[model samples]
Target: MKKILPLSATALAALIALSGCSTDTNGSSMPGMDHGSSAMSTAPPTNVGTETGADHNAADAMFAQSMLPHHSQAVEMSDIMLAKPGMDAKIVSLAKDIKAAQGPEITTMTNFLNSWGESTTMTGNHSMAGMLAGTDLDKLKASQGTEAAKMFLTQMTAHHEGALEMAKIEVSGGKNAEAVTLAKSIVSSQEAEIKAMTELLATL
Candidate 1:
């Protein structure tokens, strides 16, 4: 009976030790569960697009809005130059390049305004520099040959100058990365074109 009693107590001790081991295993698993929860909680935010999409300011909006009409007028003038007969080959090529470049840019600016929830049209009576008066356009349309080439070059030079002014403003104050990059490109390309036109005017 004494031996039986000690064996019974020994079994009880063994059972208690096994129960303690089970409790320790469960306690260890709790840390892993907590780590998993922490990983989920620290996951990156899902609204990155919203943050990137709103990265524009008033200057960017104005650049897109005001440049839309300015670019359109330039395209119109290029078209008029292209339709004229016996135009200078250089002038014709320049007109074609202007139309090609500004047409896509107009679309890009329109998309920018639309995405920004801003009006595509300029609201005030702000006169854009180098905009041709109807009379000026009439004079350009009436002229022919070298006269037309000279007129187009002179007018386009002024137009490019106005664009450079606007682009410089955008480069200085615009918040959108794409808009600023575009403004820089305009400054570079238009400055070169202006120099070319000046040389062409001298030749004429």
Candidate 2:
């Protein structure tokens, strides 16, 4: 289920402005707002697809670009657990939830990029916070029984923290309203899961 934030319109607009947009009073585009392809200048292209352009920006693009892979890794992690034997029921459920929630988000962000005339593919070498290292994944793959469950929890906690970092960046710097909203949702949902994982970790 999606969590609804209590942010008012004024608050949401204020956040977008703080992200460095320069919208007019009616929340339309500001003429001189920078539209560079960096995270700093994302305001929806003024005339990308519609008769009037969608209100989004580079921060939105970065959020989507970074998050798509981030979410994909999470789903992959979930799949790893699901494919293994003798997993704890609780951990299996958690993995399923993470996979279910993130799969749709990946698609939504893909659509967001397609609509903006932006390539969904990110360029250059980049590192995202919380992604499992190759060795980390290998360790999880090699483990079995309780050790496997323990490894998954430990690794996924770090993974979720990395997601929180990315989401926070999007919340503070993104320009697209929908993108910002998703960022807030990620923060809320993932934080709860982190708590659950922490508690589960203590028992193991």
RMSD (CA, Å), each prediction: 12.1, 17.7
Model 1 over residues 1-204: C-alpha lDDT tens digits?
999999999989976665565466744433444464334433334255456457898889888888898899999999999999888889999999999888998888888877777899988787777788899999998999998999999999999999999999999999999899988988998999999999999999
Candidate 2, lDDT over the whole model: 0.83
* lDDT per residue as tens, model 2, 30-109: 33443442323333443335532356777788889989998998998899999998899998999999999999999999
Clashing pairs for predicted structure model 1, backbone only: none
Off by over 4 Å in 1: 1-53
lDDT minimum window of 10 residues, candidate 1: 37-46
Model 1 scores a C-alpha lDDT of 0.85
What are the per-model numbers of colliding residue pairs? 0, 6
Clashing pairs in 2: 42-57, 42-58, 43-56, 43-57, 44-56, 44-57
- Which candidate number has the best lDDT? 1
lDDT of each: 0.85, 0.83
RMSD of 2: 17.7
Give the distance in Å from residue 55's predicted Cα in candidate 1 to where it truly belongs.
1.6
